[model samples]
Target: MKMSDVAKLANVSPATVSRVLSNPDLVSKETREKVMEVINKVNYKPHIVARQFRTKETKIILVVVPDITSAFFSRVLRGIEHVAVKNGYQVILGDTENDTDRELEYINLLLQKQADGMVLLTARQDKEKLEEIAEHFPMVLACEYMDGSNVPTVSIDNISSARKVTEHLIQQGHTKIAHITGPINVVLGRDRLRGFQQAMMSHDLEIDSAYIQEGDFTFESGYNQMLKLLALEAPPTAVFAFNDEMGMGAIKAVKDSNLLVPNDVAIVGFDNIKMASVIEPNLTTIDQPKYEIGKKAMELLLNLINGEALQKKRFVMKDELIVRESSELVKNMP
Candidate 1:
């Protein structure tokens, strides 16, 4: 019913109850737990508007994503929501659809005080502008980040992960390997491409310019790019797509061409989304901890909101290479 009722039920003063609700970190852990138990038992919901009026904060977080329809971003959103709800904050999704102007519009909410903080799933703005906003507002970058910026970020090392996946393909006795890259403009895309190159060069294999096609991390883009690779005079024996959607699209292209996966052309991908495992031929991919990245990003933003110092600006999470059916070919002859 009321916070006072909660306070009475918890046997704590009204001020203590307020502190526990508004600023749980300020209260003792035991006391905070006691207050929370009573509040939960009584089903007490705080007056959000009134609380905002008192604290000059909305307790609202805005998470901006480049593509809302993506399963990878959706998983990340779930993790962010889980943390936000536990900490008495609400999450609002801002789907930018890879539009820079639309992304800026969402950032305006943070500047206008409509949201207490923001977690940018991807940054489309210039580095200077992003730094300016991070300097003034509680913000953290998740999944994607800008180079040479001090903004707090939670992400896996795309370069290293990409290299590992490519090396896996190379080690399987495939010298002719192709890469379907993400948009080269994005940091992750560039890093992944660089890693692919690194692996090829290290193995003394040459990368044909025609074998490299850029995709927009979409199913259509992947599908179209694979067709180009398939039409080449000397098509690659194996392919590595920057993301799983592209990998699946490539598999489709291969099938339509009357070729078999791994038998004719092995394939690998990044971001081990749910569909990767369920596909006709399970995709071998790099598993980025998307949900964990989202959770850590929110935690970092909360620290910024509370004026707590972060131990580090860059939060590099670990990634793993998952071997699956799509790239299961073992070449008996090179």
Candidate 2:
């Protein structure tokens, strides 16, 4: 049934029906209930497809992630899907796979009115381009943030989370701790690296340049970076990978080298992904509320879509460290 039919049944103008749908709070409780009762009795469903032709809104939110294979993104996607489905909206996924050109293409699609809003997982795009796009549509930055801009974002305090992981390693008496990180250009990568540095400096320990290696937040990159560290003349006693994928990779690399984990070398990782606990040496890492981050971002986007005023621009989630066998060297002793 059309909204006009519902409006006629409820004896109200179609504008009132539109207001009730967009912002029920703007209408009185009695009017809102009366409209909803008629909506339910008639089972009226607006033709969103036709509405899009006139209003330029498809009621679809595009979620862009660097990679879909990573379990971290999977949880985040779940959160977004949960909220989107609840609010009578649809979500579309765009996997950029760390390709800047692909990212730009997806953004261009959104700009062309194929989608109503976007949630970006990377910060590699041009700042000016993003600012220009923000003028016309609502956008939320998830898992990463733009440099030198106040974009509405949903993410954990990466710097603090990374510092906590580093401190955990230090407290275990690992002076020569190594770091395996994602691309340095990404905000999370840089913040995590800075946290590692800050933790080392706080203890009056020199941040050894040799112990630092860069990865692309992939398992293979983690494995190769670990190999490089192990080949060094004086390999570090402990290692910290930015994510669980790399952390698992580090464990596999150490195992292949015939080294005993936590005994010969300790390892820690971030993002308590599902596989973290399943691995032989359970990983000690920071637990980011990945699903909650996704859910909150969608909820905020819905509020914006409904014309609700936002009290804050950024939503910062909390992170926790889950200590397991991987980083617990002494605790693992026989």
Candidate 3:
């Protein structure tokens, strides 16, 4: 049966009928029960496609990620789905493959009316474009946030977390430490690098240019950068990679060079993924609340969708350091 038919039988306005079906919370319990009763009797199910033509909303939330295959992102997506499904919304994932063009293509779902709102995990678009779209849409940033924007975001304090991890190594008596960082252009990469620098400075350790390596947040980059560090005349006893993939790569590189992890070279990584513990020496890294970040970002987006005001535009979650076999407090392991 049609929505109009359901409204006529329920003796309610078409808007009321739509609210009861699409967003039951917006309708009072009395009105909702009455409409649902008529809807059940008539077996009314509005054609979702046809309904979107009038309301300009598809009741779908688009989630964009850099790499869908990465297990790190999988956890976050799970959290987003949990809340979206519970709130009567659907989630569509878009893999940008680290391409800005691909990201923009999926973002068109908003203007094309294929989705109601968007949640971005890693934003690669221009600030001007994002600012323009976010001004009139329900959007939230997760994991990676934009600089100089009012868009709501949920993420761990990358700078402080990185500093804490680096300090952990220093406390273990590592005087010459090295770092493998993600692309410095992105916010995550830059903030993490800054944290490492600050930690060295706090301990009055000399910041050696030879110890810093730039990585693209990939396994290959991690392996290659670590090889360079291992070849140095004065190699570091401790190394920190931006993510676990890179950290694992570094561990492999050290092993390939006939060196032992946490013995010849202690290593630390970020994002304590499943592999962190499964590795030979295990990994000592920072654990970001990936799932919680996803949940909170989606929750914030839904609030914006429902026209709710936010007291804080940014939500900072807690990040903890998970110490394992990779970064033990043994200095000069022979």
lDDT (Cα atoms) of all candidates against the true structure: 0.92, 0.89, 0.91
* Stronger candidate by lDDT (1 vs 3): 1
- Put down candidate 1 lDDT per residue, 3-113, tens digits, no spaces: 888889999998999998667899999999999999888889989888888889998999999999887898899999999999988999999999989999999999999
lDDT digits (tens) for residues 1-334 of candidate 2: 8888889999999989988987888999999999999998988887777788868788899999998888999999999999998876799999999898999999998889788788888768888888778667777888888756666789998998999999999999888899998899888899999999999999998788989999999999999999999999989989999899999999999999999788888999999999999998999999999999999988877776677777987888999999999877565332
Stretch of 10 with least lDDT, candidate 2: 325-334
With a 3 Å backbone cut-off (N, CA, C), the pairs that clash in candidate 3 are none
Q: How accurate is candidate 2 locally (lDDT)?
A: 0.89
Give lDDT for model 3: 0.91
Candidate 3 lDDT over residue span 85-132, tens digit each:
998899999999888889899888876767889999987788888878
* TM-score of each candidate structure, all chains considered together: 0.89, 0.86, 0.89
How many steric overlaps does candidate 2 have? 0
- Superposed Cα deviation of residue 296, candidate 2 (Å): 1.1
